[model samples]
Target: MLDPELVERITARRAELDELEEQLAEQLAEVRAERDELAVAERVLERIARQLAE
Candidate 1:
């Protein structure tokens, strides 16, 4: 059987990893949202430049 203390430590570490995963997921979502916004801004600029060229 595994030592009780070892098991407890493993459980704590797992919880910590779970929290880190949640934080990383949140950050990834924010990055994706910013990227999408930048893409939209780029498109708008392109359209403006085309209009000005004509």
Candidate 2:
């Protein structure tokens, strides 16, 4: 069995961890969006190069 103080501390720490997890998820989503945009740009560049070659 845990003491009251320890239980309170654990609860606080869990809340902090949850907030950090949310922040990390938002950052990951931004990174994924940037990566997807880059991929599209790469495909467009490749198409332009092929057109130029022909």
Which candidate tops TM-score? Answer: 1
Q: What's the true lDDT of residue 18 in model 1? A: 100
Instruction: Please list the Cα RMSD from the true structure of every candidate, rounded to 1 decimal place.
Output: 0.4, 1.1
Question: How does model 1 score by TM-score?
Answer: 0.97
- lDDT tens readout by residue for model 1, 1-54: 889999999999999999999999999999999999999999999999999999
User: Residue-wise lDDT of candidate 2 within 1-54, one digit each (tens)?
Assistant: 779999999999999999999999999999999999999999999999999999
In angstroms, how far off is 50's CA in candidate 1? 0.3
Worst 10 residues of 1 by lDDT: 1-10
Q: Model 1, 10: alpha-carbon shift in Å?
A: 0.5
Q: Which portions of model 1 miss their true places by more than 4 Å? A: none
The true-versus-predicted C-alpha distance at residue 15 of model 1, in Å, is 0.3
Worst 10 residues of 2 by lDDT: 1-10
Candidate 1 lDDT for residue 11: 99
